[model samples]
Target: MMFGSRGKARFLAAVEGLESAVRDRDAKRCTRGLREIHRAYGKAGDQEIAEGGARLAALLPELPDGPRGGLAVFVGACVERGADARRCAPAVLAGLAQALEAAEEFCERWAASGGGDFPEPDDGDPGPGVVERGGHCAAFGWWTLPQWEMAAAAMLSHVEVRKELDSIVRARLLRDLRTVTEASGHDFKCLEQVLLVLDDEPLVALDRSSGAGYALRMTGLGDTFQLHTLLADVLIGGGHLPGQAPSAREAAVCRDAPGQVPTTGSFNLVAPDGSLLWNEGTPADIPVVDGVRLLVLDPPPYRRGWPAGRFFPNMPGDLVLERVLGAEETAQWFTQVAPAKG
Candidate 1:
């Protein structure tokens, strides 16, 4: 529903009040402002909600720690409450993305300077530092960065946000997250969760022969063995395969021989142009197309694995497959034996 002029005015006023309350750290005022905003959202239309989102995004970089975090959560809640997040949340995502980049740079510089004087971050704070025994420590930003990262992750978890995000933006966010994780030497729970959400997002699986398409979600199956195992299930479920499942021994052949009998691994994934989808990185690194990734399942000798060495005839098997189907699957394959005749 579209908002009348008065409703729009009320939303603007509520946003302004919330920003002021956050800056003042006035809990009572903050609550009142939040209530007013919620009331406005209930009465306002999608365009007004999006406009309000833009206003909140403008204020995000200037908010203090508690208020910033709280506001991020509130935005996610608004999406959950059916606020047309596809329209309203992209600006919020962009704001968080920019803030995270700025925070990362600020922390890197602060750490390098060894507690020396540094300019305030884009957030307008004095940088994350605290006094201790009459000395300042620059290490505090490392701790503070996680809060912001998690807040961004929480917002991104929404389905609308994930669908609305541009592929380039999503990839950059993942790269930035990895950089921050490597630099900080800290494993963030949010990082893992977000990786699963983004990397394992459903892809369009196309059947070349029949031209049928399916939205396949390979959750927790980015690794080789798990991925193929799930792929086999998908094939069987989709009626692309017949009879009972094959043994692990035969299934292992899918990694190399694409079309040999007695193994469902003969199927290969290719691009829309029928080119091999080679990967030097994990599945998350796969290129996305048209806001979604596509995988064309073709008759085997699956060549999606790592490229072979040029000079050395037998340098090693495909590194991508070796990495995907690690020792764990090898061990499992060795343990299984043909069924004993009764």
Candidate 2:
């Protein structure tokens, strides 16, 4: 049976509650959200998401106690279903912070022991955009990186960084795959097949230097900082206006002069009907809304100041306003209608 409108609304609410729970790391909310999912799954009709939600609920208990663990479990549960990565960002950021702190501590100890400067990354072409490869990397190496790091910590006696990361890598020797294969109770030959598949995987790569060219290929443990930083950027870079673009001749008249827009956050301009008029950053680009000339303004500053404003400066308000208003093209078409000049 198809879900009625009320059912659809319930399903949507359940999803929203789940996302909020995940983002806020609210265990009570999560439990409520899971109940909502279980109750609404039949009406939702899409078994995959429902099943995914169940799997996530199952995984939640296995996770360590903390907000990070809850977020991580949420991220893992939603992995197969293309859950918004941003929703679990707090968890990812926490893990990255922990890993980076461990790495830095190791680095400092190594330098104290006369290791000198940490080696620079070898010169090579910039790797593919992290987002393009992040999913595969996260999926494959999710369990692997922490395992390897722990093994490294055990081997070194002290928690010191090793000059030869390759040495640490060599000792492990496809341990991740072997563990998974054994757990699967598959034939040994299946391991070979799995290797072949992994070899051709988009995110996986051969690390000739690290593995001594022993046919070792693995996906990179996607860098959390870089991935999220890029996500923060470029996420809001472009978007469309409420409606389709006006015809070409009509668009020409709406073009704002160059050098009038700010560089970043330029798409904040609002149309007369309160919808954003595309990214054409400029007041001049605003069309006559409801037969009245319109102008866009920057959103008001936070009443209580930003939560982290002391630690991190907010981008200038004037710059933000300019960026939203100065761009040349606008969704507002007023070819037949003239904007009043003051």
Task: Name the candidate that leads on TM-score.
Answer: 1
Question: Which lDDT tens digits does candidate 1 get at residues 1-342?
Answer: 244777877877898898898788787887788779878766665665666665665566555444554566556555444455555455556655655575456457646657343332243333334323112223233334554554455455455556567878877776766665566555654544454443345565554444445555543222333344446545653355553444544333333333323333435556555555532223453346666555665555433332211111111112111012234533343232122112
Q: What C-alpha RMSD separates each model from the true structure?
A: 14.9, 24.5
Per residue, candidate 2 scores C-alpha lDDT tens digits across 88-122 of 33234334334333333433344444543332212
What is residue 284's positional error in candidate 2, in angstroms?
Answer: 62
Off by over 4 Å in 1: 1-16, 19-66, 113-144, 154-160, 189-232, 242-282, 285-342
What is the C-alpha local distance difference test score of candidate 2?
0.31
At residue 81, give the lDDT of candidate 2. Answer: 43
Q: On a 0 to 100 scale, what is the lDDT of residue 102 in model 2?
A: 37
The 10-residue segment with the lowest total lDDT in model 1: 308-317
